[model samples]
Target: MAKHPSLQTSKHQRFWKNRRVFLTGHTGFKGAWLSLWLISVGAKVTGYALKAPTEPNLFELLELRKDMISIVADIRDLGRLKAEMKKAKPDIVIHMAAQPIVRRSYKNPPETYETNVMGTVNLFEAVRACKSVRVVLNITTDKVYENKEIDKAYKESESLGGYDPYSASKACSEIVTASYRHSFFNPNEYGKHKVAVASARAGNVIGGGDWASDRLVPDCVRAVLRGKKIEIRNPGATRPWQYVLDPLNGYLLLCERLYKNGAKFAGAWNIGPDLKDCKSVGWIARKFCDYWGSSKTCSIQKGKHPHEAHFLKLDNLKAKKQLGWYPKWDINEALSKVVEWTKAYESGLGVREISEKQIRDFEGFPQLNDAELY
Candidate 1:
């Protein structure tokens, strides 16, 4: 694996240590990374989700089940999810389980809505019933914003709208979260500890261990590894691309704030990269090839591509000023680290070691500096 530059001390590490965290969708790519990171910091984590979506997904590859109380359950199953939540009795809850893909949403709209909207509602209901739960962080997508093909970065105050099934479902999830916060956890009826909820909207995340279809980085990595040219559905599509860890840090920071301040910090927040890093799909593909030493090229698919937004970006000034959070890695460095991790995993290295190495590298934890320690 290529050497990753040292990261500065993040408040996320210090705040999360020894915390009891319930993470939904622990079997997904981003959720697996978050679970591993939480475990690395000595947090007790209980994960509730289905099996890994794909065989090579980060959930199975990293063996997160070993560190977490992995419960094979679906978010749509209210009884099962509530039972697990009640048993875990976690202090903090992060709801990331959702129908996360746009193309797949087209194939199964009902499943997408059931999982994304009603699943979120059910999770919030469970959080309300759990007396031990103090802070809840709901993860939504940047696509929740109503796009008009404009160049301006989206702010948290922007209207929630979506044209696609996946995006609309997330938007609906946000609505559900807000409704619960107002109706159930109102300051008048329920005290701060009664429940604090914050919705987090993040930009397009790219990283290693994501074997999902219809994503830029994963598609490119899979294609390059198999010596095939990547088919770019929308080559000119612009997105705010950041490393997976970038938003994960923001999520943790938000959780810390909610834990400490309770209702004072309850609201929607955007955790995205700097606006300047927003680049087109083609630009990101070329950069990936350069870093991975692959000459693979991407061609715009003539007719198979579905309708997608041409431009999307986020204004993270709210997070920077309010939460004091900023992305530590640029697009180039983020892509480099992702490629390095995948290369190492593909070389027959232990997945647990690879996962721990990333956490150690990002947190600058001295004890895990040596890979042999894992």
Candidate 2:
């Protein structure tokens, strides 16, 4: 949490000011952003995850080791995770580590299940032992829903199914979270164990400090940097694209509500952009190129690629009506921020400073259009 003028104050400041958080996958894109935001909000964070998936990472860029107790370990190692949990005695736990790439999951299904499913079990086992933790938010993906290839948005109560190995593993993760809640941490038996657990499903989160492969935003950044024509796969497929911080805000708010009111806030949630912003990949690439000052149009990749959802959106009415969560930035604005970040990176600006400023900008709630990007 590098200091910026805008991140100086948060609405939930009183709740998270001194809370201790045990965060998994802090080395990755969303993890790094969440860790920084927590620090900015005056929270103590202990990051537990494997070595960063990418070379140039946000964790190193922001020097997060100074703010958090960065631990390099595997989530699959239950003994090690339990020891760390006991040592840290965190007040809250956010599980974000997983084999997140769909293509990679296809390449190695066993690894995905081992890391996503068994790894979830290992986390709950650790939670069972460490009573210091009161709230646990397991971060899953929008792909947990069974895609019917229609324009209909999926709700939290919808049937849980997955088309790909990655999606299936995450669906399993959700099931594991539910089982732990019903079996061990039942709210009716709140007197026995005072822990509340919930799972969060988010749309396509785009933000700064992401340099992963097979992701649309990072792919666009790399193409622009290398002067290559942006490549588009399944251009007609639509997705619920949103800025990363939007979902992060939902997660934090949910944690705050759960801390004060236990069982009522504990359940599955969806943090997605407005329905109008759910646009096709071609629209995203086109908007991104316009923002990045690239005249080169997107070149649609020919031939068969891995199967992906032709239409995917999330019914965020639950989070909106329940948690009062809404996306501050829309799709076009999200793409513009991505361009701004890339420009800053190319100009050799201190990314820590720029990232902090972006967080502040979102906090300021700058004006953005509600129209569909298409």
Candidate 3:
């Protein structure tokens, strides 16, 4: 496959410098990482989302609010969201705010649908009214695709389906994005609107400073720190796990391409790890346990858990072919970084510096010279 240049490649460095970016969900794990990346590359960023969802979050660890125009608000507040966004007058918009937890979604289905579905509707509506915005990349999840419970990887062309509330809500968000794209921001009418919209679906992303509940990595980290056993649910279930920075790089690349090529780059794309990186949950737990050097252990939690896909993966061939994006670090490398970040946080050793250094390191990795299709 043709590999895209490393993120923040010298070719794209100047483009991101002083780039005005309006990013939603900056307090979340992926958003915090993306915010740091943007700041590293010299982007003027504005972050809007509910205050960091967790007590100890990447946002506060990095003191990200000092770097961007941080707004503590809900995405469902359309009038307030539109007003704040209009005031920011951003050149690019990345919508990432949503009720992201699958388990939490089951307990609060109404909130999930309202935020993920209608929140998307509000974002597009806001973007449509904003003349300064050129590109909008809505971040969804790999769960948006229908799960036939097979070992096959899903492509963007696959039908959208989800059994769980979080998954189904994200599917609805995808449909909403398509409707808005073809109806209001159609590529054919680019000359009139000058706005291009795209969405990204990524697999399980594990990294540091995620104190959110019910996630494997964070649960393990918190559990280890507290000297408790990590609870493992669905250990046999497999996932396409990549470092948080891996897909964040793809998101930045998508925004860059959409900014330059317009409709040619506007659509749903999967930013997932390579086929070899797709590991079972049990394997990931073992790897993390080994790397963490912890006497702490795990036990499979037996209970009636909400339904989750047993074997889920994304066919990232389109991203590799069209955008030259590639996963820089494999699952082990990703786990190592997670260990590094967790240690930094646990030891209280410059968490922000460590996180930023990792981002810098990722951008300097050996990049593919040209695009190759597998």
Candidate 4:
């Protein structure tokens, strides 16, 4: 593999400075981190999403509304979405709003499809109306692949399939991105439209400030805080785990490439950790327990749960070779950071300061230990 430069590399800063970015789902975990990163790099961000999905969410934790234009709305509302896009007149669009939980999808499949599939359609429709938009990056999951429960990692060219409603909905979302790319933002006609469209598929991302349900790290955090054992539903299932900033770095790098090269960079790409980091649920739980330095531990939750893939991973060679993006933090470093931030929050220390420091550290820049923002 080729050596890749650190994120926020000098050239990237030049590209992102003063750039207009329209980001959906900025209230969510990954979105909040990306929103903060964008702001730190000098991007003018307009965030559109429902209110923070979880109480004590990162959006409110960071007080992000004070930093950007935040619009509280549903992704399915085409008219409202279009009006907002028109108003923002953004140069780049990043679609992240969706019904992201897998178990929740099994409970309400209709809402899942409506939000993940049709919401994607509505975003493209809004993009069609907004002429200022030159790039659109839709974030999807690594589960979009047709999981045969094998050890092989999935590539961007592999067949798209999903056994669960959430996975299936994201597969449909990927198809929607492809349709838009071919029909509206066709690379062959780059001269005519001057718009580029791409979709990013990333593996399970763990970090601080995620309060979402049914996830490994959040479950561990909650259990540890309460001095209870962490519940492991599927102890043996393995996933390509990387820190949150690793994949977000890839997203920003891809966006920059798509903006400058246009057609050449338009398509689906996978951003994930190295194969060695694909750890089982039990392994992650145990490691996280060790990092927390608490008496709390892991306990297998015995119950018939809805079906989920036993083994999942992504082939990140394309991103590494083409975009010069690489996963910076391994599972160990990731879990340590999560524990560090969670403990700081529990001790009533400054979270925004810790979060910013993490970003700076990840970018190979100077850590802003005293750079406090509320």
| Best by the TM-score measure | 2
TM-scores for all candidates: the values are: 0.92, 0.96, 0.95, 0.95
Candidate 3 segments whose C-alpha is farther than 4 A from its true place: 1-12, 368-374
Q: Model 1 lDDT vs. the true structure?
A: 0.84
In model 4, the runs with Cα more than 4 Å from the true position are 1-11, 365-374
Give residue 8's lDDT in candidate 4 (0 to 100). 42
Task: Give the better candidate number (2 or 4) by TM-score.
Answer: 2
lDDT, candidates in the order shown: 0.84, 0.90, 0.88, 0.91
Question: What are the candidates' C-alpha RMSDs?
Answer: 5.7, 2.5, 4.1, 6.2
Clashing pairs in 2: none
> Candidate 3 on 1-374: residue-level lDDT in tens?
11113344544477788899999999998899888888777788999999889997889888877778999998998898899889999999999999999999999999999999999999988887777999999999999998999999999999999999999999999999999999989999998988999999999999987888999898888777888888899999999999998898899899999999998998999999988899998888888989999766679998788788999999998998899898888899899999998888778799877886787678777765225423
lDDT of 2 by residue, 207-299 (tens): 887999998889888898999998989889999999888899889999988777888888999998889889999989988988887796789
Q: Which 10-residue span in candidate 3 carries the lowest summed lDDT?
A: 1-10
- Residue lDDT tens for model 1, 325-365: 77777798789988998898879888777666676666662
lDDT at position 228, candidate 2? 92
Prediction 3 TM-score vs. true: 0.95
lDDT of 2: 0.90
Pairwise TM-score winner, candidates 2 and 3: 2
Candidate with more favorable, higher lDDT: 1 or 2: 2
- lDDT winner: 4
lDDT for 129 (candidate 4): 95
